[model samples]
Target: MKTMTRPRYRLAIAAVAAATALTACGGGSTGADGGLPSNVSFGGGASGAIYGVLATGMAEIVNTNLQGVNARAEATAGGLQNTRLVRDGELTFGLTDPRVVYPAVRASGEFADEPPAEDLRFVMNGYPSLYQVTALDPNIRSIGDLRGKRVCTAAGIQTAMLGELLTPYGLAVGDLSLSNLEWTECADRMKAGDIDVIGYAGGPGAAVLIQAFAGSPTAHIVGIDPDKATAMSAQFPWWKPSTLPAGTYDGQTAEVPTVEISGGTLVTRADTSEELVHQFLTALESHFDQFSKVHPLASYYSLPGTATNTMSDVLPTHPGAARFYRDKGIPGY
Candidate 1:
């Protein structure tokens, strides 16, 4: 993986999304008259990705169901930043990617030089993600095509994934004319034909790719070689087998075989109120249909699916969430 720097795109969610749904039964416990006295906040990914979108939906759901307990979503640089916020108790909850969450808790990988976040707690694990290599040029079709081409990505994590994506093709940073432009800048340059590929690692139907498709009606989503999927996963343990079904993106007529990543997670601090976590999970499960409607990528966030995917020997589920899963008979951490 290349040692690329993360970009600065820190913009807080200016306005809280208003909750529209009515509360369902079996929520959190309250004190004297109602819920908690003050408001709580949720941290999400950079504004454009699925994590940020889900965070906004979570806040709206919380505010809608539990009246006095206002919840807000904070837009962040993504999981690495959000995990620190949640671990330090700066955020009541956060939407994060497992790549960062696992390391933050264990102080491994990117966080090797830092102390482990002993306070981190799992809330919900969700959605399979992929390394979306979007290109405006029809000539660019696979990782091999990126050779000697100008490829751009912003964050270190995204760059690491990009490096891993290239390994099977026997490519490296020296094999291409690489650039470290911010994500938005990459998009702009790609549109201007200054960059051949704009790469990112996230769930399907990423907003940037959607806008790219709009900008270049015939823009293609360059896929990894299906034959190399297993070798790639073996070489990079974080990657898993993935496939982008036909119609995942507009104008995409055929399934694009790819690799899945270990990410798309919701986490909280260990000390956060169990009742609050419980209620949040309850609201999430009850109103999941509405959340799924917020973004096409959200279709991956089903209870059973998330439960089955979340459990790992490394990450631990929160006690509050564990109880919810146990009672519901969902087999997971």
Candidate 2:
């Protein structure tokens, strides 16, 4: 294991720049219903990303099922920016990871410069994004095995989570030659053999991983030790134990142990009227089939108990969403 001399992590400057540029833009105006906006916007994340794709699907579902409500997905930077947008009411709802919003809620991490988003509220849980430690090297089978390897991952939660994942193994991000690049670029570098490992967070069959795998015949997902996976879940409730079943990707024949955090979460401000949130959930549940058809990852939200399976302890559910879940007889609502 060799430690690098330079800093290990770098924030995604491109994403921050994108968020700054879009800050001046605003969503639709409020409708006649108790300050609820007539045109609802969901922060879809960077265009064509999984979260963005799912957000677009959700927008269509709302536009079709809810009367007089115009919903559309807006292409923003990513989760962190989405949280800021939702908190400022620029976006009616934001599809982001639970952990991504925690920083804003507590005014820590990337959001340390901002005020605590006390009004941030969860609308509903979305698909689970598993932390996939993908590597083109077949020998890289565990987290500790990357000590001296070249690594690449996106900024924000992925970088932080990867650091945390390495901590218990007595390694740090600095131990590897790490670079922070967008997922697409990371895949490109993997294809070029510019990096040995590319850690990513997305759905099991995420296209990014597929592309990275296609770059090399030896590309495979490295499994987290089962005991470490359990420890991580117990330590961080948002990181529940999950498995990438065999054949999830080419060359991945054995089930790989991993941890998953559900995101694609739609969150709104607490002040958004109860009626509006309730109506949105009703439409989503009613036309789940149509909504899921928008993207394969969208179907994950249709799973049993999806509505209330959010990070309630961090970002509490909005009254509107809670009421809807209670009416549907969901426990813990």
Error of 1 at 1 (Å): 15
TM-score of each: 0.79, 0.86
Q: What's the residue-level lDDT of 233 in candidate 1?
A: 77
What are the lDDT figures for the candidates, one per model?
A: 0.72, 0.78
C-alpha root-mean-square deviation, candidate 2: 3.8
Candidate 2, superposed: residue stretches over 4 Å from native = 1-36, 215-217, 234-237
Q: Which digits, one per residue and each the tens of the lDDT, describe model 2 over residues 1-333?
A: 332233333335656655664455554434446645667788877676777788888888778877777777777777778888888877778877867787788898788999898988888887768889988777887898999899988765777888877776788888888888767888888899888998887788878799898737888888888888888777666688888889988877889888888868888887776787888888888888788787887777753556754567778888888888888888776
The count of residue-pair clashes in candidate 2 stands at 0
- Per-residue error for 331 in candidate 2, Å, reads 1.7
Per-candidate clashes, comma-separated: 1, 0
Residue 131, candidate 2: C-alpha displacement in angstroms: 1.1
Over 1-333, each residue of candidate 1 has an lDDT whose tens digit, in order, gives 223344343332322221111111111233554335356777776576667787888889889887678777676666777677667666777677766766787898888988798877777767778878888778887789888888888756777778888899898766877788766777777788787888887777776677667747768888887778889977766677788878877888998878887566777766666777787778878888887887776777666766653435466777778877777898544
